[model samples]
Target: MEDNSRSKNRREFIQSGMRLSLALALGSVSGLALSKVVKDEYVWQIDPFECTQCGRCATECVMTPSAVKCVHAYDLCGYCDLCGGYFKPDANQLSTAAENQLCPTAAIERRFIEEPYFEYIINEDLCIGCAKCVEGCTAFGNGSLHLQIIHDICLNCNECAIARVCPSNAIKRVKAENSYLIKGDFSKEQES
Candidate 1:
């Protein structure tokens, strides 16, 4: 009878240990799965259409020199002699000279591709997110020049500083694949 009792206790103990081990394994697997699901659901994105050009993206961001910068849509652009993006609206006339240019750093390079056709290029390193150029471009031209967040420079913080202060609610989290160079109009397809 004592032997039978001892064997029964031993079986119970073994079964209890096995149950505990299985529970722990299952808990670990569930935790990993939950984390992956959360990670896959979140991403960062900026909307160009609703942006207010507040200039907060330039200064408020945690990254040094900020991830926000201006991008030019060459296809939508007319490449005219008078580029609204490069010149101040109040300027007496459009000219390549430094004083007339809207960009504080003169970061935009204007090259003549042909008669009445000019190429506008942004020097990303020098841009300060002032939006002066973008504002100029959008006002009088084809709305080609616009602000974009450079992912390499972005901190990709849990909550973006720019999004917090954006009055137009233009910045939001989106999937990583569809992130950059968001052109405002759907009619204009991605040009080669």
Candidate 2:
């Protein structure tokens, strides 16, 4: 009788173990089916028009040195020798002197284009996204200089730190294909 009881107990334990294993496998499968896979379908972008150049981008981004960089729209650019984006308002001369430069990082590189035009290029590595150049450009010249998210440097966080803190609500999630909001493109569209 004792042997019979032990055998029954062993059978019950084996059945319970098998049931638990089956339940676990089914639960795992159900979880996988219910869960949605997230692809890299979207990325963070800044609309140049919406941006107020509040200078928050330089400090609010999660990445040290920030993934934001200045992009100069050559087509929109007047290519002025005395670029408002490059030179301080009180500049003594239209020279490459650090004192006369508006960019604190000296990111805007000036090159002589013609008698009066000078092409300004942004050094992405040196740009701090301070928007001082953007403000200066808009205030005194054609608004060609603007900030853009460098996707290669950007982590593409689900919730971007800069977007949350943006005073102007400029930052937004964009389709990866249409990530960059170029200044000249918008201007051309509006002109047409």
Candidate 3:
């Protein structure tokens, strides 16, 4: 009986130890899975204010045409017929001619809003992320033209090639819900 009691106690102790080990393993696996779910909420982005528009976005992105595209802040735009962002600096006339356009792809489409005012829109498919329009607008216009990451086309690489080579460190991870850093929004923040 004494031997049998000792054997039972040993069996119980082994079972208890196994149970504790299993619980710990399960808890650790759960924690790791939860962390991954939390991480999925964020995506890579470009901070417009920090971006120098060195034209690296056009060349350094892993994607062929690049996931970076030009974004226009119409609210902050002056709607000028002679848009600095839309027309070449040496444009022969402020007309809607392909030759007079600053963008190599002719991505910018101008629609007459009224006399001396035209609404400019960027065709993302045609944009090459060259930043020429952005440079021209910021230098000579209301600074509405800017670059932004198009998440739809982005591969969301673990280590972004463009971010690594970015001269201004403009690229960063941002929450998926509020990914875009609009030019108008940045201007408002600077004022405050």
Candidate 4:
């Protein structure tokens, strides 16, 4: 009878241990799943490293004005008075005249910082994401002006229309924190 009682207790103890193990295993899986969900949060962005300065970003976006906009990495900028992103190739003068402007929309505004240093500002309201400035910047100056998806203006479509037709295959869903892939000193630029 004592042996029977001991055996019964042993069975109960084993069962309790198994139950606790099962619970722990289930809890671990749940925790892992939750972490994955949080880590996988993604957003649509243009990979400037892969972008070829194609004109499609302007026309292919579902949004009328398009979410893609030229962003200047000031740290990467040469601050040249004859900024390639701001001025046309054959521009006779280094002035703010419409004829001298590379951007058709006049979205890029040049501000005089010093004698030779100038600041280029993108007027988001007027920008059409045409890549004219981007192309010019890449060809003539340090590639400070690159295209990026303006999250505030983006529709965040389940499947981005621009991504489908992207010739360089530069547009895609990226983890939220890794979205803006700029060419140079990207981490430094993000700190500010």
Candidate 5:
């Protein structure tokens, strides 16, 4: 009788284990379905028009180095040698010296385009999305320097951490097909 009871207990345990495994699989599938829906309909993006350059994009994101980065609208850019986006407003001199650079990371690289026109290129890897350059450019230049979310790096969290803390309410969901709210059109580069 004792042996029979032991076998019955073992059978009950096995049954319970099977039930739990089925439940877990069903739950996982539902989660995957929800995520798929989100991916298909929308993606996280920043509205450059509403952005106030409040310096939160760098710190509010879940990632150590936030997914947001600076992008240049070259069409709107004057390509000035002394770029407001590149140099500090009160810079002692308009040089590439660390002290004179507006960006803390020196992410904006100034390349000589011609006699006085210097192209500013963003190294996304080095950018921290502090928006100091954005602020400077908007104040003094053509407002070509804008912060954008690099979708490749962005996790598209269901509730974006940066969006929650954004002072200007700039971050929002946009359609996957039209994910970017670019200040300067980049279609010409894409065509080439």
Candidate 6:
């Protein structure tokens, strides 16, 4: 009888140990799976297509110089001797005169890369996001010189101020890795 009782207790102990081990193993597996699922849900992406070119990106941004700035697309650019974005539409002619330039701050620097090929560079410090240059580019030149949100100046807020006031419903939060410079469908080839 005593031997039987001892054997019964030992068996019970082994069974309990096995159950505990199985539970621990299952718990760990589930925990890992849950973590993976959560990680998969968290991905970053920005939709440059949605940007409305609203001026808020210039002021509401936390940075001194708003992260949003105009970028020149040279590939789609006509490189015209007279850049519409640089020169005022009413200007007498395509001259380097400050009065004739559309840019309020003279941020667009025009250099003669070659005949009929002018390279337009933006001085970011002077850019005000007035969209004057973008408007000119879109109207007469290639749809280059679009506005982009610069990450370095962006606060990366949970809710972007520019996103709220955007008339075209542009401005989307994307992952940090894929944050900016997405020229989707703009067709402007990157300049070398």
User: Which predicted model would earn the best lDDT?
Assistant: 2
- Which stretches of model 4 miss by more than 4 angstroms? 1-39, 187-192
Q: CA lDDT, every prediction?
A: 0.81, 0.91, 0.90, 0.88, 0.89, 0.72
Query: What local lDDT does model 2 show for residue 131?
Result: 93
Q: Write the per-residue lDDT of candidate 3 for residues 62-116, one digit (tens) a residue.
A: 8989999999988889998888899999999988889999999999999987887
lDDT of 2 at 102: 96
Worst 10 residues of 4 by lDDT: 181-190
Model 1 Cα lDDT, one tens digit per residue, 1-192: 999999999999999999999999999999998787744444556677777777787887787777888987677888878888888777776778898898999999999888878899999999877788878877888888888888878878999988988888888887776667467443354442
Best by TM-score: 2
Question: Over 4 Å off in model 6, which ranges?
Answer: 1-54, 184-192
* Regions of candidate 3 where Cα sits further than 4 Å from its true position: 1-40, 186-192
Lowest summed lDDT window (length 10), candidate 5: 183-192
Q: Tens-digit lDDT track for model 6 on 1-192?
A: 999999999999999999999999999999998786633222222244555455566676656666677877566677888787899999987778898999888999989888778889999889876778877877787767778776656666667766777777677654555455546333343442
User: On residues 38-134, what C-alpha lDDT tens digit does candidate 2 reach at each position?
Assistant: 5549999999999999999999889989899889988889998878899999999999999999999888889887788788999999999999999
Runs of candidate 2 with Cα error greater than 4 angstroms are 1-40, 189-192
Off by over 4 Å in 5: 1-39, 186-192
How far is 35's C-alpha from truth in model 5 (Å)? 18
* Lowest-sum lDDT 10-residue window in model 3: 34-43
Select the stronger candidate by lDDT from 5 and 6: 5
TM of each candidate vs. truth: 0.75, 0.79, 0.78, 0.76, 0.76, 0.68
Q: Could you give the candidate ranking by lDDT, starting with the highest? A: 2, 3, 5, 4, 1, 6
* Candidate 1 vs 6: which has more lDDT: 1
Report the Cα lDDT for residue 107, model 3. 93
